[model samples]
Target chain A: MAGQSQQINISDLDVPQLADVRKQLEEELTHLTNSFSQLKQAQAKFRSCIDSVKEVAPQNQGKTILVPLTNSLYVPGKLSDLENVIVDIGTGYYVKKTRAEAVKHYEGKIDYIRTNLETLQETIQKKQDNMSVVASILQSKLQAQASDKANKD
Target chain B: MSLEARLQAASSEYARLQAELSAAVESRQRLDAQLSENELVKKEFAVLTPNNTVYKLIGPVLVRQDPADARATVDKRLEFIRSEIKRVEAQLTDYDARTEKKKDEVCLFCFPPLSRRAHPPLHRQLVQIQAQIQAQGQHTAAATAATA
Candidate 1:
């Protein structure tokens, strides 16, 4: 049957006719894009590729929770023990000033407080000295009175 | 219906919130500006306010009463009070000078001149002079009426 079909073709075709036939064959070989299954198949293939990536890569991770140690004194959002962090620092912000400038202001304040404390301490010391002197004087007076009494006896 | 519709709704909500935030920011800015203006005005008014020495002289300057027992309790409360009084007097003088210095700035606020305090020295002299003048005028008027 193959030999009979091959022998039936005559070699009488011209160049223009052969060219037209070749063009018609090419047009006929082109695929129709209106097929729904082709689109679905392409989509499935894309999804399979995504699934393969998911399997090879990582899975959906959950949120992380940070737990403090048992002896940890500080909680995440809790302030200081008896005061807030800012107030606990024992500093005040100056009016329309920077930290360094405010520190300079505090330097004067610290000096003033130190001076007052020293003066108070000194005055207290002086009072204590006066008290000791009076105590000695009173003790001597009592001794003198006792001696006088003994002499009279 | 779809993710795009949901996203569009979210975007619209976000935009509305953003607009509200912008309006709030503008209002805050306006309030801040108004507050600053008010402070400046107050400072200017205070500066322009005329200071009188009267307030200083109005108070008595009697000595603090001595403690009943200076030897007892070992406290320096009376001394501290006297010291505090002196410090306050000095501060009052300093503040009065400051007020006088700020008088020009206070003029922008446009207030009446502060009345003078009842200065003992000036008041005493005024009383004496007024009495003498009244007596002289009365004597002269009596003499004139007798002649007529």
Candidate 2:
């Protein structure tokens, strides 16, 4: 009978119930904070990649380069045609493109990610604000209850 | 909505947001890893000279490609990653907003931050419930007096 309904009145909750609610909110806050940091890290990495692509494009035409076999290893390589570009079209297929097309593609991608990052930042701020509000309300309510009990005693 | 319905809706919304956030974080990690790999490929392209052999995978076959072509493909991949990240992030943001609104709606009592004008229907519902409770209590008292 006690577990039949899930309705809860926050104002009517006793100390034990409030403590349970607080625990849940704290967990959610922790999860959101972790997600925010991870998103930030991803944004930073994306920005760095864009910058590197921009800087490395014009200067590398017809120059000797080493390709990475692994993170810490590389093999000797060179570009036979500066104008010809290979693009992977998924399913293990490759297509051809010009250097300009490649640059345009990455630039378009950068714009898309930038918009996404901005929206995500706003959401993160909202979550943070919500968490703080919840925490403060819970703190004051607990304190108020304690003082009420003291006055009566 | 009734309190029970409102509570259920809010809990569901919170759960959905949690799932969406988790998925977004997972996709971000995957995109970050792809970016790291492409960064290395871009580095390789920066130092490419004429006659350097670039191998590309075509249907499980490693075919030799021009260095320029390989770099273009790498750039395209990086851009694809960017698009994916954006899509996931947008979903995350949307879910976050919904979750925020649901949280506020459910905790209307704990956090009476909602203005009366903004929550007229809910305010009406609560007032109705309070009046009903008072009426029931008075009726019970009258019955007890009659029995005595």
Identify the leading candidate in terms of lDDT: 2
Please give the CA lDDT of all the candidate structures: 0.36, 0.59
Give the winner by DockQ: 2
Say which docking band candidate 1 falls in: incorrect
Docking class of 2: incorrect
lDDT of 2 by residue, B110-135 (tens): 23544569777766765564444334
Instruction: Estimate TM-scores for all models.
Output: 0.23, 0.43
Least accurate stretch of 10 residues (summed lDDT) in model 1 chain B? B49-58
lDDT of 1 by residue, B23-132 (tens): 43344444444444334323322322122011111133322211222112113433444455465556545643443343333232222322225345544544454344
Quick one: how many clashes does candidate 1 have? 6
Clashes of each: 6, 13
